[model samples]
Target: MRPITAIGFDADDTLWQNEQYYRLTEQSFVDLLGEFAEGAHITERLLEAEKRNLAYYGFGIKGFTLSMIETAIEITGGQVSTDTIAEILEIGRNLLRHPVEKLPHVEETLEALNGEYLLVLITKGDLFDQERKLAQSGLGDFFDAVEIVSDKNATTYRRIFSKLADGPERAMMVGNSLKSDIVPAIAAGSYGVFIPHALTWVVEHVEPPTDAPRFRQIEHLGQLGSVIEAIKAA
Candidate 1:
């Protein structure tokens, strides 16, 4: 393996348990839905609605709020009263105040890795929400550059990577989501290191390729230091 000149990181689960926060808010939405409409049907409708809304709103708070509204209307056949909509909006607003509880050893590990690699933060979601989390987490300073991407597909990664000063060959992407991070990073001619998160959404999965040389796997962010050291040694 070539010595890595720079390293890129995926935000969210890679650095902290982001989806769990979303999941908590989602449960709140589901509970609210039960009062006005079909019970667990909230989950079903939101999933279906987000499948389409993802194109327009991408991922993040705004998109999620829209999904909540759309799901309510879809499940209720437009009979969802204003009261239900108000409750949903209130729940979404409450999420803005959601606490950010980080994964274990994240801060210490990032501190250890910062000086050794040109670290960049690459994440995809609503800019405001992502930025809010980044700011609140106090982890932004560890990265040399911050990229809040609109999507994490192969094409998007390819385009963003080509714009980097180091180029893909000398860069490695370390992240949690196989679909959004590893697969796309590998496709972009970069080395990809997968860090499996404890909690993951179904949408963030990808079938691993049988013949990929540039992909590696680790259990968590703390394991990344060894991979970096090995790359440097080689």
Candidate 2:
């Protein structure tokens, strides 16, 4: 692996606790609709709705809330009450108000690499929601740039790198999702670093590519500094 001058980090599960909120809200959703169907059935249907609505609503709490309401309507055959719908909206609002909890070593790792590299936060989700999280995270000042993109793809990665002096060949992407963060950045000629998170959303998943030319996997964010050191040495 070659040295990277610019490093992009994915937000959400990579830096802070995010998906756990979704999971918790989902459980609440199931309980709210307990009279309509079983928790397992509601969960399965909600997942399906979320996947189906991805294109329309994009990603984040707003979309998830809509999907939950849709699923409630579908499963209950329109028997879902207005009060339940209001409760679903409240659930979403509660998610947006959820406190940002930085994962282990997030602040320390960022501090370690603070002035050593050009750090950019490349995350995809609702613009307002992402901005809110960043503001709440207290790690915003560590980043040289912040990009809240509509999607993360090879073309998107290339586009982001194109504006940088070092370009994609001298950049690296670190994130939890194999499909969004790892594969696309690797395909775009940057080193892709995968930091697996246990509570990743199902829709963000894909098998890690077997033939990725420049890829690294570390157990935790605390190991990122060492990984970068090894890359520089290589």
Candidate 3:
């Protein structure tokens, strides 16, 4: 394993309690549409709507809000009421205003690695919302840069690492999603560290790439220092 000179951190679940807020908003959507369908059915439809709208609206609370409205209309056969629509919009607004809760050891781990290696925050979402969370996180000073991208893919990782380090071989990406964070980074020739989250969004789900040469999995952010040390020792 080549020693990692630059490290990229995925902002959402890797650094803070992101998915849980989305999950709470999802439950709120189900409750709002309880009259039209069961909670499980509503949840399923919402996920479908989110996936369907991903390309058109991209990701974030705004897209999610629009999808919920669309799902409500579809579930109720276009007869969904104005008041319900208003409530759903309120749910989204509340989510936007929700407090950011940094996960365990996030600050400590980042502090440990700061200045020793290049640190960049690579997160994909609505720019405004992501920026808001970063400001709220108060860990902004630790990162050498912040990238709020439209997507995460092999090409994107390669481009980012090219500028951030000597090469992809000297870069490492740590995040919760295998599809977005691990597999693509590994494919781009960077090391990928998987830190699983209990409530990952379905859209981000993929089997861990245990066979990948550049892949590593740690249970949480608290273990990140050890992973970095192991990579450095190699």
Candidate 4:
């Protein structure tokens, strides 16, 4: 119920077409590795590699490319061909080159809230890739500040909110990932707004904190304004 002084947003699936592209790339990876392993097995192994490599590679297409290569190598017992590796690399490049498509109502919502509140983009991923996506998004100017951090945690939200706005208590975080954007921001004493994306990555999946006073879930970005108003009146 604290006056919302600033708002933080998660960029990936929340703002534009991200997870869907990743899903397509993942299917491409499976197809590329089909000769060495079954599609299901390949997908399972690649997911395992991705999860294991998160600490080493963090997040983004580059890490995903590396994980796919590692999975290929592991599946083939180190006999995977160089050409396949090159193809996998190309898949990552394609992901990087994919045009940014802003979701429905995203521009309108940002335009509506741009001057009314401090809008900060707080997303986590490879800095270059994140920056590239933001630049391509064309929604970059709407944000007052941007924080591309290594991870999202309670501490991360607290630090960002304290420095960029009044504090976490006076800020709200809106994103698709309950794990990365909602839980941590709420834990940091900020309102956590969940905007569901159809193709959210499995790794980011988690139960919603339905009992939390600061937690809210909306069908899409279009419903965000009503949620904000309700939050204000709460």
Q: What does candidate 2's lDDT look like per residue over 1-234, in tens digits?
A: 346888999999999999999999999999999988899999999999999999999888888999999999999998889999999999989998999999999999999888888899999988898999999999999999998888899998998877853889999999999989999999999999999999988887899876776988999999998888887887
Q: How accurate is candidate 4 locally (lDDT)?
A: 0.92
The count of residue-pair clashes in candidate 4 stands at 0
Alpha-carbon deviation at 178 in model 2, angstroms: 0.6
**What value does the lDDT take at residue 41 in candidate 4?**
95
By lDDT, is 3 or 4 better? Answer: 4
Query: 93-146 in candidate 3: lDDT tens per residue?
Result: 998898999999999999998998899999999999999999999999999989
Candidate topping lDDT? 4
Q: Please provide TM-scores, in order, for all candidate models, with all chains considered together.
A: 0.92, 0.97, 0.97, 0.97
Looking at candidate 2, the ten consecutive residues that score lowest on lDDT are: 159-168
Q: Write the per-residue lDDT of candidate 4 for residues 1-234, one digit (tens) a residue.
A: 358989999999899889888889999988888888889999899899999999998988888999989998999999999998899999989998888888889999999999899999999988988899899889999999999998999999999999999999999999999999999999999999999988889999999999999999998898999988887786
- What TM-score, to 2 decimals, does candidate 2 have? 0.97
Going through the candidates in the order shown, the clash numbers are: 0, 0, 0, 0
How accurate locally is residue 216 in candidate 3, as Cα lDDT from 0 to 100? 95
In the range 70-165, model 1's lDDT, one tens digit per residue, is: 988877788988998998888887767776677777898889878777788899887887788889999989988899988887776666666764
Better-scoring candidate (TM-score), 1 or 4 = 4
**Candidate 1 steric clashes:** 0
Weakest lDDT window of 10 consecutive positions for candidate 3: 225-234
